[model samples]
Target chain A: MALCQTSVLKVYHAVIEDVITNVRDAFLDEGVDEQVLQEMKQIWRNKLLASKAVELSPDSSDGSHPPPIVANNPKSNKAANAKAKKAAAATAVTSQPQIGGSSSASSLVALKSSAGMAAGSGMKNGLVPIKQEVNSQNPPPLHPTSGAALLQKQQQAASSGQGSIPIVATLDPNRIMPVNITLPSPAGSASSESRVLTIQVPASALQENQLTQILTAHLISSIMSLPTTLASSVLQQHVNAALSSANHQKNLAASKQLDGALDSSDEDESEESDDNIDNDDDDDLDKDDDEDVEHEDAAEEEPLNSEDDVTDEDSAEMFDTDNVIVCQYDKITRSRNKWKFYLKDGIMNMRGKDYVFQKSNGDAEW
Target chain B: MSYQLYRNTTLGNTLQESLDELIQYGQITPGLAFKVLLQFDKSINNALNQRVKARVTFKAGKLNTYRFCDNVWTLMLNDVEFREVHEFVKVDKVKIVACDGKSGEF
Candidate 1:
């Protein structure tokens, strides 16, 4: 049996429903609204659907029929961001007149209408409509960037945890200025401090939940304030760790070239020498040969050190790519250092989609 | 002791991202986000256990690295081939992180 995109979507839907159902009371206990939990689920599902990487058609077991047209325009995106901020801001400014009649019907519906209005006003304001034709029926889609920024800001506030009055002010203006006014200064110093704290703190410093909460808050704030590429930089750091080994090899070859008494070096000969120094000693009669031989022995061990560090960092690298498996090992048997793994309850992310598996057997050697 | 490793998956990342949006807007707290993730752990584990009946088998051309730490097995495989009933998917490299399924209070 194999899981398809639809099945994966179904599993995701089930998981969201299950989580909301279970965590609702806990959140309520913490003075959080049940509606907020539902909204979180909606936002989570919408963002996943927007990825358009997985198909959640109407006929699928996943019953929430996502909006047909994902409008992917600046207008809709702005509207979505504004609506989110307004929703966040609504709690703070209880006096402001709700955009729509009822608070429940207001957010999404108001976003659709307001998105059209914003789009309409933009066109009237000499904003040239390039390829996008303003259609009322097709409201602006929830673009992921605005959604990410929105989340970034939200997490930044949430990290502050309590009495974060400044966040409301930041959102009220609906301009980039507020972020600069509120975040950059404190976030710069705090981010470095928290990062050091996270590094210094042991796994058992606080309760798991509290630790996760603190780390997540720090991570979100730092990520939000990062001026460079956002998520890509985080991922690049991980990839670079693995890449360092390759780079070390390249550097090793370069050093070998210089050590060869400035002779015009052949790449193949250098590679062969690195692999087998004894063979290289017989093959190449070069000056400074003793120095090169001694350097090769030391250089050979550098890659192993690189490999060790890479493996240590492996635990932190996210397995969110298309070709990874997040699962549970029922039992792992090792005979003569060869291992056989029995895995279960697996979510295999492959081929740019997701799959669920009940049982899997993997064969590998130590 | 619900498995939190799945939180690194795409679904988990999206939820965290969404929760971030809510938190940044002051709609929810970081604590609430953590609660959501805990629930997510339980929910996803249960969903995968009860809903998915599919079985898969795979062989690795070479197991690059393997580590067993904290009752979790992390295996990095190169040149792997996965076979399902109907199709097969081959990947250059794949990482498998499996936690103790039956060890926790599910």
Candidate 2:
């Protein structure tokens, strides 16, 4: 069981590294420098990664594994740093063999069989661990209803003496280097006294939300939701909140008169610096506000100019080299009115293939 | 960089206001933009075959425009100048397609 968790951790770490390295590569390919990478690192980690970890990890009925540094609390900053390293390194070797073994088909079948008996979970909102024999190749949209039934079947799969509580990774587990040491500041400098910590991410987090997906089944829900564990950078968190708040806003239906929309949108945007919950009913007009994140960039010297200040027209055209990769839902013709399914991988670091087509004649809902 | 852009004439003020509303959301399509330009120009620059080149940076869609006389650029946005650069104008609309491009030798 411990081996399984360790491997899961390793997989998630790999995913994060791959995502970050890919961003680094994308910038480098465009001849950008390390400063850009450093700037993006915090945003990506805080906005996407840490939240995803909390999203995917199964509810802790998986046994209270020593409460993580509970009694053996480190005394000083140095002591804490040293303790973290020892714990990280000690688990690396034991999990290495499990990582290798899980990749083979025979072991996966055994793991699945064992997991079948470990059924009946206390997951929130009645979410059950995927009990079906997980087939990685043909990934299906695991709807809520289907997930529950699948768990029931898995419980049946577990015969006398063998249980299915432990989910052997049934997805494509990518190879990732276990641990990485990142310096918050340059070594040998005065700031070098700051904690130099070794972080371990589960390679699984990068490769596939395989673990997370099994737990929640809410993959294609909305473009702007995150898990509780989304820690790391405070700046990115605020940005994420702002983005999600903006995206999920109930797009106000534009009337033919457009008088209400004009006034309301103007007021919402003006007071936006103060209240983020300002929802403009007309999102079509507010389309590329995401691009204007330049205003919200904490590191940049963004002028304290409000939308009202740029009187002549606040519109300016910029090149689309903003390093966003898009994965848009091709068939958005679903019966659920209009749903935007974005599997943001660039990190598709993207906002779907952006194309301006078929303008609506005033009375459209979405 | 520090001139009162919306200076003097009624046309300049109206064009400035119109440009803000037109491009407020983003770029408009060429066909849509042409219709918008016609509202400002059909009576003013009243010639059947007067072809116009769009000079960016200056929001003078309503006023009569000039062509780029020399091979030099006209406006500068984000360090890149608006030369005979039609390729960079793909995802964007020609918001200000005026009579000539030779506004100034920047």
Candidate 3:
């Protein structure tokens, strides 16, 4: 059955009323303004009317309203302001790690203080002191190579067998500084990920624009020099583990089916090796192999259900047609293998219009 | 099954959009938004159960696809004709997602 547009609107109004009335106590307990709840309802109604799926009376919105929400539908600009503050704080944190290792520790302190201020203060003016404190700590490097020179000195001191423990303690904090900086860029911007790698060299050692080439060469050489034997051994270990686990599972299955199946166990081992190869090369042939394996080992390991209930609903929304019905099924039975459905409490979006139904009966076959 | 699936419907979608806007403005937390959605679930269920009194009957030329899993039925129909009172609406394709009716009772 089809419902008229007016009834759809009426149902929506009741839903809005019930939701707001029910949720008001929670909002009140949280110390949130009642006005915000009203604003949300107003925005919800406005958006529904804007959909143009149904004609709503213009006077309904204009008449007998209690402080109509701002036309923009935003009640406050707090999150935007917080984002701006966070961006500023992020730049400050990222720049500080380079000055000195000790400074990195202090930058953490500054970050925490700035974050606290950002959260508690509604006024932008409160952030000025925090920014200024961060800026004061970010003194210009004495020389671009000073950090490298310090690292060189630390290494020299360690090699000389002098008190290397203090130098090591100072160096450890800078190594961890990158991890702290990674936390601030919530947007995951590429530019934020690119940190300044200060490479120390004598004036004659580097030419302009050659640094990137040198860096890339070093990176490639390091990658090319990977320990192949160690990697092979690790991979071999993983394969052995999988084979053993698969064999154990097969044994479990065999035991459950019938005892003393040695010949079957040997055949299963060979099949498992083939399954491993198929898993490694997950191509069209692997799917056929998997089906074969499923037929034999169905009792050993049930294949995971690739689609669960959540994705089922998501796929419904993802379906091309908006002509969809979401309802409750009271009974679904097959008479002579022809499907009959009895459904109720349904909401449907069909042909760009909304509908609500109390009962639905449907018939289909195979 | 809960009315969370209804969030895909027009009314639920609009309500969610409104709540999202409020959350973005920092006027509400995600926790409160969740509470609001729960309320919406109950509200929509009750409204549909008690307020709406329409009955619909439909016949499909072909059940293009049918899936039953997790006690839910997802059926894709082709050449659907819905009859309500004296009105008839025909659509080329429609998808039906039905949850167990008795399972959602609170």
Candidate 4:
């Protein structure tokens, strides 16, 4: 029975070893890129160095063992790591010259010596550089770049019957390089070029229901600030607006004159009807014939008299101008219902001075 | 350097001729900058606005003339000058054409 038990134990031990070897081979087959693998090795080395430094320090007393002086304390670990990273980056920048010289050779020699000490210390002194080498050489194929290998190694170390020796590993560090670029220049010489000004107006500047007023104010301010030569073109646009208004007024005046002439002609027709009634009693027998003759005469005279009347009415309308004028003066300038005024040569040339309104009202009413 | 421009026909040629004349008169050149003004009578404005999209084209010789806004008119070769003229004229009605020598037509 004793012999059988011994054989069973041996078989169990052999099986476990095979399992471990398979896991290691699987990691190795995964074939992580050499750069990443090298970086991982460097990180592991740093972690080992840090833990060793912490163990040499006297302040810590966790009862397991004296922690390394280089091991960052839990309380200040994040800040220390950041500072270390910055220091490492600066050193890397400075070490670029050393990369091609004897200094690199000396550093490599130092690294080898330190790696040897870490390996010799074993798990009792909490040094496990050999374990890092073993994992690096035989990383699992399924998870070559995964953190799982590191975790599994930690577990194995813990279960290896090595008492209370703390295991440490490092994290991957981020690196960035600087770059330079240039932009092409725009056409035209600097002296002759016009600069584009973009101004952002906040929504609050436009208050509720006052968008037009605020916009006009902003536009006027910008225009007024411009050089006179540039502002003249903008000012010319105002003249065009005035001309359009004058044209509208002229059309309205012509229509009003036509309406007046039609009313006068209707009055003349009513008078003729009364005159025919007076003549009808005097000659009742010939009244129908005379009425026909009179109607023909009236038709013949109507067009000629209407044309004359239109001319007269137009002349009278031009002279008898009782009209109101509204002119805006501030941010926006506007002239409303000024029929007696005409736009000529970029100016509002008033035909009848008496038609001008002395008082002005705000455009908000319109 | 001055170069003569030749054309086979004159149909729709009034604006092109005017631009060519302006260039010949040394009023504009390939490197010289100048502004152009175009006026469209109400009928023309209505007809073109309803049917055409504005574009500018350049013809180069000893002098370069730029045609703009439905190719109805031509101007000198400054882009900034063209933009200035465009701003002055009512784009929906009249097309203004101008140019500076540096950047051709836009």
| Candidate topping DockQ | 3
For model 1 chain A, where is the 10-residue window of minimal lDDT? Answer: A204-213
TM-score of chain B of each: 0.93, 0.24, 0.94, 0.22
lDDT of 1 by residue, A31-62 (tens): 88778877777777776766664666556524
What is the alpha-carbon lDDT of model 2 when measured against the actual structure? 0.27
Ranking by TM-score: 3, 1, 2, 4
lDDT of 4 at B74: 27
iRMSD, all candidates: 2.7, 24.5, 2.0, 38.8
**TM-score preference between candidates 1 and 4, better one:** 1
Residue-level lDDT of model 4, residues B1-106, one tens digit each, is 1001111111012223333333444434322111111111121222222322222111111112223353122222111111111331111111112122112111
Best by TM-score: 3
In order, the Cα lDDT scores of the candidates are 0.56, 0.27, 0.56, 0.27
Per-residue lDDT tens digits for candidate 3, residues B1-106, read 3567888888888788788778767899999999999989888888888899888889988887888999888888889888888897889899889889888776
Q: How many residue pairs clash (N, CA or C atoms closer than 3 angstroms) in each of the candidate models, in the order given? A: 6, 42, 1, 21
Tens-digit lDDT string for candidate 3 (A158-266): 2332322222222322131110000111122332221212222221111111111122111212222224444334333443454445445545544343322122343
Off by over 4 Å in 1: A27-35, A57-64, A68-322
lDDT of 4 by residue, A57-169 (tens): 23223444323334324313644565587689889988875444433454433332232222223233332221222233343324322223223333343333144343322
- Alpha-carbon TM-score of each model against the true structure: 0.47, 0.14, 0.51, 0.12
